[model samples]
Target: MRPLTPGDVRIAACREGDLVALDRHLPSPSHPRRYTRQLAGLGTLLVAWDGGQPVGHCEVRWDGCAAAEVRGVVGDCPEVNGLFVWPESLRRHGIGTALITTAEDLVRDRSGPRIGLGVKDGNTRAAALYVRLGYRPAVPRYLDRWSYVDQDGRMHDNADPCAFLVKELG
Candidate 1:
């Protein structure tokens, strides 16, 4: 396989037609519902593609922060949530960073002055990445709780201690 670079990735909001492939590469069939949400003007599923492969994704909740503690703190600024790059071998090759910066650009294009995201407390690596990207602590730690069903039909209910972080776009 050819080595991947930042230049090799193309990031864009998940379109109606991208749902099928997204359902395949992404964790679950949630992309379809996410696409419906996108169409309803709620949030967007931004997908990062490397050539023909869907390599990463991050949801931009344009309405406001998804975390309860950070919600009203940043007004209506978009939130970058659930950023992921598949295949452990592909990490640190700029794909995750590209997804984040692209999300920022998209929000900045809409005149958004800031953005926010929640990081699970134990996820030091992700927190470091957010800090390097200029996000700072915004709210006191809170419970990060959610549930999801995987492609295999298993349901997961998770709750974690997390912190909300925000960054001003320059």
Candidate 2:
């Protein structure tokens, strides 16, 4: 796939119908229903469409896994979680940045001084992107990883060694 230009991307609030794309991005086919439910539990879910196709997504949770993980570290900050870019080929084209930026806009609308997110420890590319976008390592060196149940109510572990980061909304 050719690299996408910023002008060709549209980032917007996620609709319930986005469950299709969300499911496709999940590790297995059985994960979307539960994922959709979780996204609904969030304060906001932002999706990036590239030339009208769903390419990436991010979400802001006011009181979910993200908040629970950084409760004291970021002190009540809304968290940007579940950021994903699909197909692996659609990456490195600013779609992730657009999704995160949209998530930050949601945080700003809520009048937050800062927004928080977690990056898996070994994921240097993602960590670099967060740093370049103004996020810094939060007080806690690590936080509990994310896990969720599938449609069948079976729990799935997505555990990773992660670093919590916060960005001042200036």
Candidate 3:
């Protein structure tokens, strides 16, 4: 597949009917209903669309980082959480970057001081992408916790030993 520039993807906050489409496009744990925090004003789920097809997604947590250590150390600010690109699109295809840039834009529009994201310790590729995008380590480590509901409607919780990264937005 050819590389996609950021412009190739259109990013927008997830709409009410988008849940079904996103869940069908993204992976299992990537179920859009799982992060429907937009309904509560906690955050907005940004979906990257390519010609009306959902290609990727990321949640802009306007409330703050959910990780305890990140909250305590990074303080309250928007957090770019749960970014995911469809495996078919893969990394470096610009989908992930578009999703992140959109998340940053969301925070920046809110006059947010900065944004934080948690990366699994061993995910060097993703961490490197964040670094290249101007994110730096906000905290050495943290427990990133999340849960998702499967198609069968079973709830699954997860916790990951992750490193927190933050980027100062203008």
- Which predicted model would earn the best lDDT? 1
Tell me how candidate 1 scores on lDDT: 0.83
TM-score against truth, every candidate: 0.90, 0.80, 0.87
Query: 64-157 in candidate 2: lDDT tens per residue?
Result: 3443546755666777877888868878877888888877887788657788888786889999999999999875456556567779999887
lDDT of 1 by residue, 30-132 (tens): 5766677789888888999988778899888878765566665666668887788987778899998998998888888985789888888889999999999
Which pairs of residues have clashing backbones in candidate 3? none
Model 2, residue 137: C-alpha shift (Å): 0.8
Provide the lDDT at 79 for model 2: 79
Q: Candidate 3: lDDT of 152?
A: 95
The full ranking of all candidates by lDDT, starting with the best, is 1, 3, 2
* lDDT measured at residue 135 in model 2 versus the true structure, 0 to 100: 96
Model 2 weakest lDDT span, ten residues long? 26-35
lDDT tens digits, residue span 56-127, model 3: 888887878877777888777788877888766455778898788877777787756698888998999999
Clashes of each: 0, 0, 0
**Model 1 Cα RMSD, Å?**
2.0
Candidate 1 runs further than 4 Å off: 150-156
